[model samples]
Target: MAVIANAKVETLPEPWSGAIRSGRHQLITDKPESFGGQDQGLAPYDLICSGLISCTMITLRMYAQHKGIDLGAFQVEADFCTNKEGREWIERRVHFQSPPDEALQHKVLDICSKTPVTKTLLRSLEINTQLV
Candidate 1:
């Protein structure tokens, strides 16, 4: 497995505005003005969802290509909600421009659940923090 350890984020003067760096790419993150941010870019939850969605789609595409399966255009929508119980649930809807067979659809669904981000989210996280 490839490791990504160089990702970093720096806070800007604006509240909740962060400059994120990953390799040669950079992105901005901020919350809505109602949450005391400038609303410049995706919030934390949106970034998480984006990771999961991107991973899922990439995994499926690789699998289909490797297996010589003709998976046409597709789209995925994911929603995240947390309740009083502190439980977070992510609901995802996937649609294909040309629907595949039931077997292929099931295979794709299975692969989506196994995406790196999806698996990581489902498993317990062990974070060790330190101040340099």
Candidate 2:
């Protein structure tokens, strides 16, 4: 199969610091100073959480458009946590500029929960990694 979107990440000179390249967009990521990395950008976990949040919003927007629903304006926030045992969890909150009808709101929430990224995270996806 052909690749859709491609990205590359490489470590910077600073420890635990790296940059990501996806198409025309570039972003830096780093551990906090407490973790011995310069407080440059978002940590890995933060980036994962952001991916979920971003994908959810995009999915919602597209769904709304397809359904001919007026979503108005909305925002999503995702908080991620990893316990000492390495168990991870994410909490997501959605806020709307103007509340929609109960039925439409429920539909939107259902769609958000079923976004590709959200489903992958919730269903314990297995990623096959290889060095090429």
Candidate 3:
């Protein structure tokens, strides 16, 4: 397995009061002002939660396909909370929309729990963070 120790990301301002990223691909992020965002560039917290969910789902899908157990094409909603201490602190919750058979569902969840990104967040989390 190839491990991405660090991914370098680039960001730029949108043409009209927004923000985006440019690389091999392009993405845009914006939110309403009520969420403490400038209403620009994906709200940072939402982006983080999305990362958690996407990686987990990727792993789960691959595993299920390999085992010949189709998860039946579902969506996962993921949200996370920052702990009392730091960014290194988090609570990841993934909700699968499709209700599959018990055995299939559990296996999908289990597969998510083992993805490299999930494992990194849970196990290899040692960082120097200072909250101002």
Best by lDDT: 2
Tell me the lDDT of model 2 at 71: 86
Candidate lDDT scores, in order, read 0.89, 0.90, 0.64
Every model's TM-score? 0.93, 0.88, 0.64
- Lowest-sum lDDT 10-residue window in model 2: 1-10
Worst 10 residues of 1 by lDDT: 1-10
Best-matching candidate per TM-score: 1
The residue-by-residue lDDT of candidate 1 on 52-120, one tens digit each, is 888888888999899998798998878888999999989887889999998888888899888888999
Q: Rank the candidates by TM-score, best first.
A: 1, 2, 3
lDDT (Cα, 0-100) at 122 in candidate 2 = 83
List the candidate numbers ranked by lDDT, top first: 2, 1, 3
Cα displacement (angstroms), candidate 3, residue 33, comes to 1.4
Worst 10 residues of 3 by lDDT: 14-23
In candidate 3, which residue pairs get closer than 3 Å at backbone N, Cα or C atoms, i.e. clash? 29-42
Evaluate model 2: give its TM-score.
Answer: 0.88
Tell me the tens digit of each residue's lDDT in model 2 across 31-122.
99998989899998898899999999999999988989888988999999779999879989989999989998889889988998998888
